[model samples]
Target: MRFVIKVGTSLIAPGGRIDTVLMRALVDQLDLERHEYLIVSSGAIASGMSKLAFSAKPKSVRLMQACAAVGQSLLMYTYEQLFFGKKVVAQLLLSSDDFTSALRYENLQHALHELLKLGVVPIVNENDSVSVRELVGAFGDNDELSALLATAVKADWLVLLTNVDGFYDSAGRGQKLVRTVRRLTPKMEALCGEKSELGTGGMRSKLRAAMMASENGVQVAIANGTAPQAIRNAIERKIGTYFPATKPAPKKRAKAAD
Candidate 1:
């Protein structure tokens, strides 16, 4: 089954700059990978901030979009350089409209299918420069955007890489992490903390994304992006948090019509 791995801004940026080592590690793992993968990446705004020498996330929508416009190119450049040895990387900017509209949705699926077939990994993100509502709303984070993309592609699994190891009972107080979650509840949402200054989404957004993916029959996992082999570990179910698919769907045929 194909996997949609969402790399959060927090993991991409360390100490207000892009962590090239981490980027290389991730792409290195992708180098010898067996499964077809799509990367839903978030860091344009953060990259913009770094370029403009801004100390904090901009409050104005226009400024935010402007940063996205400038940073989007740099973000892709970084990926291009890091992924030079591996499969080609294609930049895919998406908006809510793209998924909400039927014609566009089908087009997106077709495009992604072709890209993957040709050994190209689609680097997806919300069209921040174009979607104003998405820039200001809670859903601005590409966490939920990634989940939506997973549903659009009928992905078998969705992996959300965040700052923390996983969801905890408290905000780094009671426990270090919540190992596995079969289902998400209101209580889980309540435990989510505020958004980081470097990134838009918090644990709340991740939990919401997991719920959305689960409802669409996709198994979701949230884990620490800082871990060296985090993505590989998650894929092997060796560590981090796991959210199993709870939503029921039509079962597949046992065999091709015999």
Candidate 2:
């Protein structure tokens, strides 16, 4: 099955620095030949922060863009090194226009299909260095981006790998994980907590993304990336909060003998 796996900044770079061990393990999991994979990754800014020795995330758009420019290369380089001798990876820096424009979206679909046919893993990230919208909170930390890509590519599953185990209900005694969500409601939205220190998206954003994908006929799973075999487990329905795909509306038959 085709999968669009989104890895958030918290898992990619917990404390500004990129975690090579965790990344390598993820790469190993993706090395399997049975499945086609597309990666939506978030770590450029954090990596840049590490490179520049910044104590905190930059607030200014220009400063953040500068950091993204510096770290984009580092992030891709790390992926290349990790996937070497296993899989060829291509980087695609995208803005919202790429998905919004009719021509651009068609072109993106063709390119992504061709890349997958050639057994290449397309690593996608927001063009943070250039896109003002993306830099100033547009894609909800790439959760929305992943969902869009999943629908565009007609992926069977969109797996979101974050720092948490799954969507939890904090109101019920301790935190209770919601295993399966056939439908998303406003109450669930109210359960969303704060965003991570290094990441812009919180559980709310992830749930929104999941709902987007599910509505588009794509199954979604949100799981903790720090766990062992998280990606595989999510796919196998062994872990995470799973959202089953919503069936498309049936077309009405044309009037006969009119």
Candidate 3:
């Protein structure tokens, strides 16, 4: 089955830098998966900030963009090394316009299909290095980018790997974890928490991304990226906050004769 795997900054760029140990482990997990997979990764800015010797995410747009510029190359280098000998990895840095523009969108779709057809793994990320909107968080960033890709590709599943294991029942005692969410509702949406210290997205953004993909007929699962078995568990439907694919809403019936 086709899969879109999104790993956030929390797991990838912990403590404001690329966590090599965690990344290697995640890569090992990916190596075990025998199915087709596409990655939507976030952490270029967070990882870049450190290379520049900045202690934290910079406040200025120019600084963030600069960080992204530096980070994108470094990020791709790391991925290339990890994915070496396993498969050929291609980097595709995109902006919001890539998905919004009709001609660009078609080209992207064809390119992605060709890559998958050729057994090449495309590592996708926002072109934060030069993206004004992405640098300022003024549009749908990686979370939504993943969703858009899932919809466009008609993927069977979209797996979101976060720092946390999965969504929890906020009002439940001890905040009970909710597994296998069959429907996305208003109450469920309210359970989302705030964004992480180093990333633009949070449980809220993930839920929205899930909703967007689910509405387009793709199932979703939210799991912990750091777990050794996250990739396998999610595909087996044995763990994570699973959102099953639902039937599309029926079209309105024609009006009866007056």
Candidate 4:
């Protein structure tokens, strides 16, 4: 089954730059799998900040957008370099507007279908350069974008790779991790905190995004991105917090014309 994987900035860029080694390891495992894979990544802004030598994070929207524009190319280039001999990888930067309009949505889906059909892995990310403040949450972040992309592509599973192992009982206070959460509740919402240092969209946003994925008939999981063969393990149901598909599965649809 095809999978849409969302790799958070924390896992990809722990500091202010891209963590090439970790990224390569993850990509290596994905290359070994026969299943079709799509990656939704977040690290452009951080990458840009480093390249531009910005002492601190961008404050103004214009500055942030500029950094995003600059970083997106570098980020994609790094991915291309890493997967140079592995597979054909393509960059797909999106914004909420791309999904809001019916025409754009259909067009985007067709493009993605063609890419996947050609055995090319599509790397998607939000267009943070021209991002709207209203779209900064899970829906706007790569985490939520990945979940939505999974539904858009009719993927079988939605895997979210983050710094944390999985959803916890409390906001990092409780020692217990929610290994399997059948249903996300309000209490769980309270337990989740804000986003991490390396990324935006915290546990709260992830839970919210998971609800959207579950409603769209996609099985979701939250796992540590740095784990050894984490994606493969998650597929085998071997690790992290596994959230069952509570919604109906996607139905077969006509393929886009070649």
On TM-score, the leading prediction is 2
lDDT string, candidate 2, 1-258, tens digits: 788999999989989999989999887887448888999999999999999999899998898898899989999999999988888999999999999999999999888878887889999999999998987778888999999999988888899999889999765678889898887789988988889887878899999999999998898999999999898898786499999889752232221311
Ranking by lDDT: 2, 3, 1, 4
Instruction: Summarize candidate 1's per-residue lDDT along 1-258 as a digit string, tens digits.
Output: 678999988888754578888878777776335777889988888888889888888999998998889889988999899878776899999888888899999898778877777778889988898789779874659988989888877777899998788888776545667877877788888887888877888888888888788788888889888888888787687377788778753342222221
Q: Candidate 4, after superposition: displacement of residue 254 in Å?
A: 6.6
Q: Can you rank all candidates by TM-score, best first?
A: 2, 4, 1, 3
User: What would the per-residue lDDT of candidate 4 be over residues 1-258, giving only the tens digit for each residue?
Assistant: 788999998877666788999998888887434778899989888888888888677767687777788888988998999888788999998887788899999999899989887878999999887765523452646777887898899888888998878887864344688877777788888877777765778888788777788778888888888888898787687388887788778773544457
lDDT of 4: 0.81
Candidates in order, TM-scores: namely 0.91, 0.93, 0.90, 0.93
Worst 10 residues of 4 by lDDT: 131-140
TM-score of 2: 0.93
- Assess the local accuracy of residue 207 in candidate 1 as a C-alpha lDDT between 0 and 100: 86
Best by lDDT: 2
Write candidate 3's Cα lDDT for 1-258 as tens digits: 678899899988887789878887887876524667788888999889889999988888899989988988888898999888898888998888988899999899888878777778889999887889976665455888898888877787889999888999885478877887776788877877778888888887788888888888888899998787897898786487888777553232222311
Give the poorly placed runs of model 3, Cα more than 4 Å off.
31-33, 171-173, 248-258
**Lowest summed-lDDT stretch of 10 residues in model 3?**
249-258
Q: What residue pairs are clashing in model 3?
A: none
The Cα error of candidate 3 at residue 14, in Å, is 0.4
Q: Which stretches of candidate 1 lie over 4 Å from their true place?
A: 31-33, 138-140, 247-258
